[model samples]
Target: MAEFLQFAFSGLTVGAVYALVALGFTLIYNASDVVNFAQGDFVMIGGMSTVFLYATGVPLPLAAIIAILTAVIVGLLLHRLAIEPARGASPVTLIIITIGASMFIRGVAQIVFDKQFHQLPAFSGDRPIEILGATLLPQSLWVLGGGLAVFVALWLFLERTLIGKAVLATAANRLGARLVGINTAVILAIAFGVSASIGALAGVLATPITLTRFDLGTIMTLKGFAAAMLGGMGSPLGAVVGGLLLGLIEAFGAGYISSVYKDGFSFIAILVVLFVMPRGLFGGRSVERV
Candidate 1:
């Protein structure tokens, strides 16, 4: 039971990060058909920037704000410089572009941050709280709470706000949205910015627990993408469900099986699920509009 609790806690921590990254995927996918592969780098930026700023004697809250904002700006620039020029390109081209962007971001991070791992103090302090006989750190609570908050905030923004509706409209039918005076190009940029911001926020919250390093975003990004797929592509609710479920799976797997095989098991499960339900459990079948 103790070991199971440990796995659950670790998995949820990792999964919270994945969920945030997956939300980034959903945001970009909704506004533009292209998936931003550099989404993980945004997480690195958040973590690295915060560590540096905090080290420079800046207040933690202010440093976190700046780090997240910088990531948002980077995201916007990625869309403007790379994605916009290649409009109407094939999925392979877009994928390559994003992959290139991810590589570029990591290269920059290594140069700027010196490839060192850094960690920050948790927002709530370094105390462990017990949950169902499991000892969980305050930092874990931040990660989990931050994820839920982002999810709720996203729901409200999308369902209740005109800007959100415009984003959804653009995602649903770019041509129709443009015809109706919804500047989909701008929406795409906004989506990238939003996605980056979310990723950055996740990084900031999780850094205390996971530590921060220059090349940290890749695994988190991959896990998050898997979570998004597990829940359903282009589905925000799917991302959340998928992230939480993946976390629980990893937790139980690590406890029951070998910790060394935890990551391997996730991919194996993804393969099995893909074979059974290609469209995802919650995602509907795709249909192109004429």
Candidate 2:
């Protein structure tokens, strides 16, 4: 029972990061109907950039701010360069371009950060707290809280603000949004900024626990994509649940099953889910529509 609780604790901590990354996917998908494969690099940028800043003697808060801002800039540029021009192209073209962007970012990161693994100082020290037989680090609480905060902020933004409504309107009907004078171009830029910032924030929070490397984003992106797909591509709520579910599966799989196969374990279940449900738990019946 203790081990199970421990597993849950670890899963939730890591799951928080996954959920945030997944939320990034949802944001871009909802706004532009594009899956930014380079999204994971935003997380990498946050961790790597912050680590470098801290190494250069910058304060942690300042480092975090710069890191997240950098991610937003990168995301905006990727959209302007790779995605925007290819808007009239086929979906396959968009996917390839983003994938290329992802590779380019990874290569640049390796050259810049030298493929080293790095961790940040915990926000409130490294002490562990006991909760119902489970021990968790103070940083984990921050990560979890940060994830929840992002979700709530996104929910409120989408559900309340006029800009948020414009974004939704563009997603629902680009022609209609254009007719109504919504600047879809600007909204796409904002979506990229918000999505990348969220991914970067996740990196900042989870770096202490998972550690950070240039290559880390690839797997994190894949896992996040899986979680987003598992929930429903465009559903923010689904991202959270799917991430938590994946984390729990990985935890128990590592414990009772085999740690070696723990990563692959999620895929086995994903395949099963794909076969059984096709669309996913939160996903609509079909994904053909915009």
Candidate 3:
């Protein structure tokens, strides 16, 4: 039972990070049909920038804020420079462009941040709190809370605000949105910014536990993509469910099976889901009537 509790706690922590990453995917995919493969780079930027800034004598909270802002700026630049120029391109082409952007960002990070792994001090402290026969890190609570906060804030923004409705309208039908006076370009930019901000927040909260490195983005992106697919690509609720499920599977697999094959568990789950529910657990099949 203790072992189970331990794995569950660990799974929740990792799952929360995956949930944030999946949310980022949903936001960008909804705003624009193109999947931004560079989404993980936003996490890298947040973690690496925070580490660098904190090392430079900046306070932890302030450094985290600056790190998130850096990601937002980079996200804007990516939209304005790479994606905007290639507007109206084929979806495949846009996807390739995002992959290129990811590679480019990774290369720049290597030069600027080096190859060493970095981590931040926990928001509270390193003391381990006892749970029901399991120990928990204060930092883990921060990550979990941050994920919940992001979800609530996003729900409020998307459901209660006019600008948010404009974003959803743009996603539902870009031509119709534009016809109705919604500036789709602005919506796209805002989506990227929001996505980046969420990814950065995940990084900030997770780095204390997972650490950070320039090359970490690729794995993060893959996991997030899998989670999004598992939940239903365009559904926010689906992303959350998928991410937590994946995380729990991984944790249990590692605890019971070979740790070396832990990642294999995720892929196996994905394959099973694909075979059983191709549209995803939360995704509905689309139909059109003439």
Query: Which numbered prediction scores highest in TM-score against the true structure?
Result: 3
Report residue 197 deviation for candidate 2 (angstroms).
0.3
Model 2, total clashes: 0
For lDDT, the strongest prediction is 3
lDDT of 2 by residue, 178-207 (tens): 999998889988999999999999999999
- CA lDDT of each prediction against the hidden true structure: 0.88, 0.88, 0.91
Over 1-290, each residue of candidate 3 has an lDDT whose tens digit, in order, gives 88999999999899999999999998888888778899888989999999999999999999999999999999999999999899889878989999999999999999999999999999999999998889999999999899889888887888899988888888788889999999999999999999999999999999999999998889889999899999988788888888888999999999989789888999899889989999789887567675
lDDT of 3: 0.91
Taking the tens digit of each residue's C-alpha lDDT, what string does model 1 give over 148-168?
999999889888999999998
Model 1 reaches what TM-score against the true structure? 0.95
By TM-score, the better pick of 2 and 3 is 3
Clashing pairs in 2: none
Clashing pairs in 3: none
Q: Where does candidate 1 have its weakest 10-residue lDDT segment?
A: 279-288
